[model samples]
Target: MTSRAVPPATAAVPVQDASLGAAVRLVRVSKTFPIAEGRALTAVDAVDLELAPGSLTALVGPSGSGKSTLLHLVGAIERADSGSLTVDGLDLVTANRRALTGYRRGVGFVFQRFHLLPALTALDNVLAPVLPDRRPGFDRVERARELFDAVGLAGREAALPSRLSGGQQQRVAIARALINRPRLLLADEPTGNLDSRTGRDVLDLLLDLRTRHPMTVVLSTHDPAIADMADHKVTLLDGRLASSSAPSAD
Candidate 1:
């Protein structure tokens, strides 16, 4: 599908007995794809990472450095070829279909391209994720409205993607990602398409959402300035880890 589809919601919404974030860990993870002539291209080399609950980590690297692949592995869009990965104590690498489904429902993803449906309004786009199963008490529409408001798009719910500016469209995308109350958010260069000022605004929105929801966030970026804002910074080179640093008190 060109547009992102919501994962099946067979699992119940996670209870807030604790915080909204989930711990993620990776040990010697790697992924490779077969190319022409039967040779393989390693997208992610054996790498280890650990993300504490409710923390923000920035993945910084150049193009083709495996930043996106790392996020994809954690989001379960792509599987690791070897090693282990766990999120919130669930073994992702060996998770059964049902368990993986449940895990996906608790995670949200945003990309450089605001994958909003051109035909759908902002509110409709936000509500798209919950459309598959409209159980009672879900309040899908109400939650979408609230998210739009939360992202500063309250009065623009009826606006179409074509009618909204780049930043506004990105805001709608952010609202859509939050509709499921995901505990882990994966973003791949979410601000890459925006101007500097607007990118900063979108970055601020993401940081603000982190504080409001206390969810673990991992975003890939090429901008050092943006990476500096994160609580942790991880750099990749040639599908391998170059450096990992704690958050700086700037």
Candidate 2:
């Protein structure tokens, strides 16, 4: 089913618990895209949100809902039009590109397209994030293998994206996303391309990874099923918050 078909009520916003600490924070944030005549198209309005350390938060809304825009703001890929955003205490909205690159070393991303390299094997693709530049530690390949195994792609490590199933490719993307051992992970429509069963498996794997890796994860999906898995759900209505119900919306 397309993401739009699911029951949005299944996932609610997260409740704040001070124990986990704040992994990400946004206050009075807004984003606008410039149009002709120098007018602005508002994508996100003044919004405040947070992700607790080692928690899972889902940003849910339909297309053009600013869900992805919010995720990008946390990922440091794009700056907010105004206000402040912090990831693990690092100010991102005002950080320079060079600093953002350093900040990205602690942030991971999983795109809906499964941005894997077709020419390389799963292991190599995961390793690409940590090369002669990012990770200077010895045994990075071993680390990659560990991540591949963690994502349940052990024997398939040598397989190329073309040689793998869509779910497998997405798993490889997940593994690649973790290569940096980031404290915060942002995924845009992670299960959009998978069948229901495969998508469930992928979601399960993501939960397992979050538990094992102990990182804050924020994923934006048009799918409520994807959102339902999070400990926190941030819903957007017309680029504004519908609600935030966490801890237990139950």
Candidate 3:
């Protein structure tokens, strides 16, 4: 796999049970995507990962490696073919759909594409979690503003996605992901589309937020440069653990 240099220094920087704790643990996990002719595409292969509470880890790999697949497994977006996957105390491999749904709320996710609603103002997007269904008499606007402030998006709260810069839009996405105050945050190629400087800023923001509100952060990236910020980094090659080690703090 290719390892690209990170642009430069940025700065830096789970949901478990209240009692039966453990951010996440994957034991002998593997995932196989079915294909035609009784074949399968193995995306993740017997990967074992352990996440301690509030620790930040990054899964780095070239395309087609199992980083995203592993994230999906950890996020309960996909199931492992055979292995034990546990978050907090609920075993995902054996969790019922209802249990999994409840588990997911605490595991926030940010995608490569800014998934913000184009029509909704930035504030509304961030306020989604505290809507009426989740909490009665919830001040969605005020809460959204607070989050926007946290993410350094204070003024743009009233703006729509089409009016924001790439970096600004991403920051909004991050805020929205945090509306639920998740215990675990999963980000997939979060900086892929941004300029180097913007990417650096966003990364720095992530580290800063960890200090403010600690949580388990697992980010997936193919860019080695961006992966430099992670203290615990893993490399996946062809759906397997090629080299997992600590990234140099430069």
Candidate 4:
């Protein structure tokens, strides 16, 4: 029998407990894309890895190293070509479209570009993700306000993206990512567009948020300094696992 479909964003957002982090497991997973002349480029080669709940992992590599692809795979934006991929026991590789949509709702995503709505206020941007979802018990507005405070943008809620600095915009993006109280958060070069100081500040805020709301965070970055801040570091090269500082899964 098929598993119960996870409620969409229109459903009530569940209040996650402190142990809400999702555990991730991958075994020989691979993803490839077609290229010119009927050729294919392997983005994620056969690889195996595991991330413990509530742990922060850094996917460190140069450009074209598959770090972003791995993040995409985990975020359910791309499907794997072979092998098994599971997060919180949900088999991502094999999940149906509806299931994947529900899974996407549960997984928060932060991007390097800080994908905020140009016309919306910061508070509205944070609330955009769940605006369609009607959850009687949940107060999305209050939660957005709390997140603004958590990200050090409490008073700037009325500001538009154009009025905010890059750092502030990124902060708003971070807050939006957490609107669903996701158990797994994926960040693809989240600090890449900021100045050094602002980047550091964003990273600090992310780590702080992780502590307050327990979740597995997997971020991709080429900067060694950024990778150093993670609990475990995995390096990818030519779509393959080149090295890993993470311990073996028990």
The lDDT leader among the candidates is 4
Model 2 alpha-carbon drift over 4 Å, by segment: 1-22, 133-137
Candidate 1 residue 55 Cα shift, in angstroms, is 0.6
Q: What is the lDDT of residue 176 in candidate 3?
A: 86
Better of 3 and 4 by TM-score: 4
Question: Candidate 3: global Cα-lDDT?
Answer: 0.82
Ranking by lDDT: 4, 1, 2, 3
Q: List the residue pairs that clash in candidate 3.
A: 6-225, 14-183
Query: Candidate 4: lDDT over CA atoms?
Result: 0.90
- Per-residue lDDT for 83-115 in model 2, tens only? 888876678878889999888787889999898
The regions of model 4 sitting more than 4 angstroms off are 1-20, 247-250
Question: Candidate 1: where are CA atoms >4 Å away?
Answer: 1-20, 131-136, 248-250
lDDT of 3 at 99: 91
**Range of the 10 consecutive residues with the lowest summed lDDT in candidate 2:** 13-22
User: What C-alpha lDDT values do all the predictions have?
Assistant: 0.88, 0.83, 0.82, 0.90
Q: Write the per-residue lDDT of candidate 1 for residues 88-170, one digit (tens) a residue.
A: 88878888888888888888999899999999888988888774765867777778888888899888999899999999998
Could you give candidate 3's per-residue lDDT for residues 94-178 as a string of tens digits? 8999998888888788888989899999888887665365567666676678888999878888898999999999999999888
